[model samples]
Target: MGIFDFLKTKKVNDETFNSSQFQNEILAFALWKFNETNDYYKVEKELWGIQDFDLSEKQIKIIIEKLKVFNEKKN
Candidate 1:
């Protein structure tokens, strides 16, 4: 890892990635990732992206609960 790498950033388009949209997109992507392989480890990376995703408290609870259900079903 280089110090300069910390300076790098990815920009979201002005029209595409506002707060609510970012959350929705991350959730959507995580759901798709989960569906793709049914692997929690892989899905977790997407969930980390979702920490940057702006979400309401209610939304967080709902999403986490859904994830729990998914894992329970998988096990």
Candidate 2:
């Protein structure tokens, strides 16, 4: 491999980075909403509105699980 080959391979796609950042933003918003309302359904609904169905079921479930853990620790 050339000396610069590693540099090319190490570069991350902007789209992928933005997608992950967006997911983190969604998670942060969901957590904040849940903390404020203490209602999972409300937070889910808000996330749906913000994500506009972009997030998959698995992602949603993971967010819900995190929220549950956060709630437990909070109590």
Candidate 3:
């Protein structure tokens, strides 16, 4: 703990805040599209940038579950 440590800490917090804000923006857009079309699959696939991914079955199931929960909450 010394002079300028606060600045370093603040910088990390700012970066984390910015990242969270950006993620929220993307989620808002995805949810908006989902509400319009009721297409969580497309929203997850396209908006999540997983169209080209080859995820394992377990990973996909987890993703689907998360999306379902997200959609349910929105509704």
Candidate 4:
């Protein structure tokens, strides 16, 4: 099995950890890429496929907030 194959296992209540986990992983990957590129718009477009162009400090904060929310929601 793959390293992350454990994600498919049944939890205590048999509930599946679905897309939320996957989204959190993707967001983490995007964050790592953002650190490298430092181009929010380009990283959003290339990594997350978000068609946003607001490259302001507020936008960066929003992205970070999204990552935090997704991470917190992850089991």
TM-score of every prediction relative to native: 0.41, 0.58, 0.42, 0.38
Q: Is candidate 1 or candidate 3 better by lDDT?
A: 1
Candidate 4 achieves a global lDDT of: 0.51
Q: Record all residue pairs in model 4 with backbone atoms less than 3 Å apart, i.e. clashing.
A: none
Clashes of each: 0, 0, 0, 0
Model 4 lDDT per residue over 1-75, tens place = 889966553321212213466446646766687668765566556543433222334444555567556546863
User: Where does candidate 4 have its weakest 10-residue lDDT segment?
Assistant: 9-18
Model 3: lDDT of residue 59: 41
Q: Can you write out model 2's per-residue Cα lDDT over 42-75, one digit (the tens) per residue?
A: 8877765653335545566767887787778978
lDDT of 1 at 53: 41
Residue 74 CA error for candidate 1 (Å)?
Answer: 14
- Cα lDDT of candidate 2 equals 0.68
lDDT of 3 by residue, 8-67 (tens): 422123344247664465456666767787877776665545343234444434445656
- The segments of candidate 4 whose C-alpha lies over 4 angstroms from its true place after superposition are 1-18, 48-75
Best lDDT goes to which candidate?
2
Give Cα-based local distance difference scores for all models. Answer: 0.59, 0.68, 0.55, 0.51
Error of 2 at 30 (Å): 0.9
Of the two candidates 1 and 4, the one with more favorable lDDT, higher being better, is 1
- Which residues of candidate 2, in runs, are more than 4 Å off? 1-24, 51-53
